[model samples]
Target: MIFLFRIGFLEVSWVDIIDIALVSVLLYQVYKLIRGSIAVNIFLGILALYLVYLIVRAAQMELLATILGQFMGVGVLAMIILFQPEIRKFLLVIGRGTEFRENLFKSIAQWRNSYHEDVNVNEIMEAVKTLKATRTGALIVFSRDVELKFYVETGDVLDATVSKRLLLSIFNKNSPLHDGAVIIYKGKIKAARCVLPVSENDHLPPHFGLRHRSAIGMSENTATLVMVVSEETGRVILARNGIYLRGLKLKQIEQKIVEYLQNTEPANWEEISEEEPTTTEN
Candidate 1:
């Protein structure tokens, strides 16, 4: 390595600068991935502890340093276990390439729109509108490019057709299936009362309830669209890929759903009504 400068006893070289720059970039990316989540707090706490350990050791505090050194020895493994989900997500992005994943989902959406022809966007919109008016809390998950069987098994399997009346009845406060989430795939309700993972992102609005947190978590883990209706505020929210869109109107919700499911603009209700119904079973 070519020496660039000398700071007292330390020699700084071109390779050292490049190495430091690469490390800084890697740390920044990791910070971005864990920001707004509980993991970031944990990460900072660990970092602070490590700094304390170093200070104590330099001060010749042998007893405290010995204990802290033991913990620091396993720090790499501990971090791996602590940030497993974030690490997996980071690896997934690197392996698949963000553009490739987006294009793949778009192609799938286009194919589903052309062949399935059974989503009944009008019914879904009507159901959501009615739920919004009634201030009924609801969580609807639309699966795409990911298999949600693990989460689906956490609830009651319905395997029923999607209809406004069915959706309304299921979400009715008095209904047994009113709690948890309703999973929809291939334009059918595959499960009800499905317990979805809750997000650990502390930056989510304080007003967001468990339903919204679960929606965000599910979207964060899978390539899925989640819809949330607030019971207290009568607001409609959409979540996808860990991002949330709040205060959506009926038309806006419809447009978002269409774009997510079909990668196209909202379709005419008349044409949707003309299409034949499609059915499937789990």
Candidate 2:
């Protein structure tokens, strides 16, 4: 049997292809806006309730259908109330786009140059190595997308160049700023002793300490890179995009830093250390 090809429709309507493509793009954007957010769950719940209402109507259950129909009538208002935060966030993003268009491209180009600069990574690596060797506790947060200004304001504003000496001094055990995190932005230190939200995830390993927990919490909210050096064990841990890598060696940590700063996927940090003798403790 000869299959009738869609070439017949293609001859008549190129408009259909454009219409489908536009719809697909809109759906994808909508998904991107709502995915990994509370709105997605709320949307699914509403869909389920609507399905139940349809079933009730089909079954001719008048009382149930009437009740469901009433609820459905007010569902739009309920949804807006339930999703106020997400709706506000979406609107804020749209508003920012107008402002971002004025300066974003230039800023992105500048960031690109900084990412390729060897001085930045070298300075950071030296700091990490020294901090690890001395068993100095430190939390370093690299910001992305979400602004850390609120937390940055909580700490001393450094606005200084990123260098080994500065980083070392800031996190030195005896330093006044040793307790909190240092926020890094655009190849420089933005703030010192910045407080970070601690992760309350029940599934996190019990052995993970405060620094790791805080790093994970910050990562869960933003696409930021966080590095933590344990005071007790000197174990270097990395948290990014809600995943944690523990017991990273100096080299592995540097690689991860470069990868993250350059917007590339970090290599397997734990695997990178496998060639050497694994130390149970830092």
Candidate 3:
């Protein structure tokens, strides 16, 4: 309460505003990291305990304050131990951001345009047709901006050119690499047999299998398109926008991929069906 040029104690300073802004930013980042996580409960618990400790200390309760003070002294180390997984995940996310990666949207937009200009859509169509023809089960994840390094770490890193034969071999039942999803980035197969997240959709059709669920999960988590084909039925499925498009034929799948890849727009399955037939007679 020192006198600092205030007529009626309406004192404020630039340092106070700066401190508030810094705290706000830190809290916002923490909220982002802990959202949809159980670590938030642990955080609130620590905060509540701190408030109680402060109250006890202020009331001149020697025993309670002494016990609470001891807890407070080791609280930070306890928190780090208890929330080890969450803390590691948060640090990984922050580290990834500072790893000198290029802009995500710009990279995606480049791929979208490059696929149309540089890549051979006919060859891709041929591969898609071949995949459907053999009734080969396949899961191909096309990565855009968001990195799938965690999932990629779980698989064999190929970093090879995307080709029909390579994709077919990976998805062939007899092949060693047929077990998991292939992650493609910038026209290269960055990883093969990569495990992916699974969707918990209750309304999914009974026929939908694990590959579809994993594809939906990957799509939901990142800005990527997951293409899945069922080996038993030769049916094609595309996972994007957190929705699964089941029973898509070659042309429809191609169109949907081009639409999402090039435009980043939500597709209307109904409109697509009305505009083009699902099947093409041989």
138-212: candidate 3 lDDT, tens digit per residue: 888876543466778899999887777777777778998999998877667789889887876677767778988
lDDT of 1 by residue, 130-150 (tens): 998999999999864333555
Question: How well does candidate 2 score on lDDT at residue 21?
Answer: 70
Candidate 3 shows a clash count of: 0
Candidate 2 Cα outliers beyond 4 Å, as residue runs: 1-119, 144-147, 266-282
Please report, in order, the local distance difference test score of every candidate based on alpha carbons.
Answer: 0.77, 0.73, 0.70
Looking at candidate 1, the ten consecutive residues that score lowest on lDDT are 273-282
Distance from true position, residue 221, model 1, in Å?
A: 1.4
Find the candidate with the highest lDDT and give its number: 1
lDDT of 3: 0.70
Question: Quick one: best TM-score, which candidate?
Answer: 2
Where does candidate 1 stray beyond 4 Å? Answer: 1-118, 264-282
List of clashing residue pairs for candidate 1: none
Model 2 clash number: 0
Error of 2 at 93 (Å): 9.8
